[model samples]
Target: MTQVIRAYVGSLLGFLLLDALWLGFIAKDNYTQAMEGLMRDKVHIWPWIVFYTLYCMAMVYLVIRPQFNAEKASGVFIGGGVLGAAAYGAYNMTNYALLADWPLGISLQDWVWGAVVTSLSSYCGWRLARR
Candidate 1:
């Protein structure tokens, strides 16, 4: 029970930090251009809050826990990356398929970022929880 709490908190922090870096510094321009008119003038906080909460939970449960249980750090990292790629790719690809004028560039970049960020975050969380 304690492990689960620690994992959730650690992964949440990790995910937020990494995502902030990616969204705020690295891919800000790309998102702005891609979203263009599709974006709301004012950012809505609720959806993002919900997204991160759910995402971190899923990351910890589905990716980190199994690896932690198996005592495999490498597996945590690799599985996190794969899971991130698959999850984000599903969202992006579905948007591209369903939404008119969705930018392929944004989707591709997001897929890459998702894999990298999730891998690092999950690893950090697993390490912290293990300690």
Candidate 2:
């Protein structure tokens, strides 16, 4: 239980930090330009909280726990990368398909970012759990 908690915390923190960098700085201009009129002037706080919480929970349960249990060091990152790719791909592809204004560039960028960020976060979670 303690290990799980530790893993979750580490994963959440890592994810938040990396995502903050991506959304707040690195990809800000791209997102603003891509989203255009669709973005809210003031962001909603609750959705972010809920998303981060649930996403990290899924990461822990589906990726971290199994890797940790199996003592597989590399699987955490690989699994996380795969998971991120799948999740982000689904969302981005859906938007591209449904939304006329959705850009393929944005979807591609997000897929890459998601894979990198989630891979690192999963590694962090595994590290914390191991200790």
Candidate 3:
């Protein structure tokens, strides 16, 4: 529906901007790369960030009815984000299984980091909804 697309697209862009800004303060180096739109090792987090944010915002927006309130959306977004993190963990396991010799360390810790990044992004999406 029109509203669904609006919320989805709006959440994604809003998160992209806010995350970049949020990271700007907490992570100056990453913020620089994000601002420049460069593809560096640091920028690798972007994919996971964007993915989780999109999933949470979209899920919340789609589920809530005609007029989505920020509070309800935030709750749903958090739930969606947690689910996304779990999904990301599973995905990493599958990916590592496919690539036995991944240059980067193939461990549960790495997978956990992926989940952290996803959770953070989802949080950002929720924050944006409230604004």
- Each prediction's TM-score versus the true structure: 0.94, 0.95, 0.44
62-100 in candidate 3: lDDT tens per residue? 433323554554554455446545765777677667764
Off by over 4 Å in 2: 69-72
Task: Highest TM-score: give the candidate number.
Answer: 2
Which is the leading candidate under lDDT?
Answer: 2
lDDT, candidate 2, 16-125, per-residue tens: 99999999999999989988977888989999899899989989998899987666678988999999999888989999999988899999999899888989998888
Candidate 2 Cα deviation (angstroms), residue 97: 0.5
Question: Can you give the lDDT of residue 112 in candidate 1?
Answer: 89
Whichever of 1 and 2 has more lDDT, that candidate is: 2
Give candidate 3 regions above 4 Å deviation: 1-6, 14-67, 70-74, 103-110, 123-131
Ranking by TM-score: 2, 1, 3
Give the alpha carbon lDDT tens digit for every residue of 1-106 in model 1: 7887788888889999989988898889989988897888889999989988998889889988887767568898898899899989999999999999888999
Candidate 1: which stretches are off by over 4 Å?
69-72
Which pairs clash inside model 2? none
Task: At residue 21, give the lDDT of candidate 3.
Answer: 61
